[model samples]
Target: MSSYPTPTLATARLVLRPLVATDAEALFAVFSDPAVVRYWSAEPWTSVAFAEQAIARALDSYRAQSEVRFGIVLADTGALVGTVNLHHFFAQNRRCEIGYALASGHWGRGYASEALEAAIGYAFQGLDLNRIEADIDPRNGASAAVLERLGFRKEGYMPERWFVHGEMADTVNYGLLRRYWNERP
Candidate 1:
């Protein structure tokens, strides 16, 4: 896949940038909350070590040009609220998967959508990707709605796709094409 520098993206209320080591504490605070990771494939983080390790991995991935994970922050307060990432790249197909998580307290405020929109824009314009995909637990209606609002269509479903924390979860797949996004209002 093509590698591009992680640019700082801005929206009306949020900023999307690469993760930093100093963000460990704030990252821990967001990921440790069970409510924030209810639909995630992994359990709630129990330690700051996880955040530090994750930051290290992100740095490695950035260097390898394999994935780009942005730490979503409030533009005004400069507080880290969550993360949105474009990963699982398919260079031959010009495609990748989009994923994100936000603190529960920040929900209902459109932060996730704002950050995701910026990421998707970058993927299409900066990386020259043609398609982006999302996989969500079927029960995550809020996430599904966000994808739909961004012009991603429900493409397929897979039963028992993930075994997370002893639960066999179904996945609802969504996809957005460059043409579709370009036509979006």
Candidate 2:
């Protein structure tokens, strides 16, 4: 069985941990909000039931060793604020894809960046990955900014790459290699 390092990751203001069934309600609250889902791949979650199913799938992915999904919690209050994940793991290539989202209420607080930084550190140092990438919608400036701030350089832009919210969207690819991380202070 593939095992992951423990679930708890603590940053100054945030806690990243495995998603639990009880978190479904809180996740639903954030995910079902239309404003939060505007830039996300799926439409607003219709109900808690949907979030429950999503949580189940996330748990399964972890158990199967296919992905690592963490619930982003506010350390001060222990509230479920969002999620971040490392997916599409290519162990042979020592690479993976990173993805994240936060509730509308938590935007601009640097929570996403902190959470991402922690995840990247785990992937590169703890997990021994050589590269990490973020595939973002070209129009999503906020996400692009997060990747850029984390030292991921924009490598390419693929036009008309995905259909999101009924429109074809271009994708900007951002990548960070271990060589770059090793050189950072």
* CA-lDDT, candidates in order: 0.93, 0.86
lDDT of 1 at 11: 98
Model 2: per-residue lDDT, tens digit, 1-185? 23445267899999999999999999998889887776667889988999999899898987776888889999999999999998888878889898888999889999999999888888888788899988888778888898888889999999988877898878888999988877767
- Worst 10-residue lDDT window, candidate 1: 1-10
lDDT of 2 at 180: 85
Per-candidate total of colliding backbone pairs: 0, 0
Best by lDDT: 1
lDDT of 1 at 4: 51
Query: What are the runs in model 2 whose C-alpha is more than 4 Å off?
Result: 1-6
List model 1 lDDT by residue over 117-160, tens digit each: 99999999999999999999989899999999999999999999
How much is the lDDT of residue 120 in candidate 2?
88
Which regions of candidate 1 deviate over 4 angstroms? none
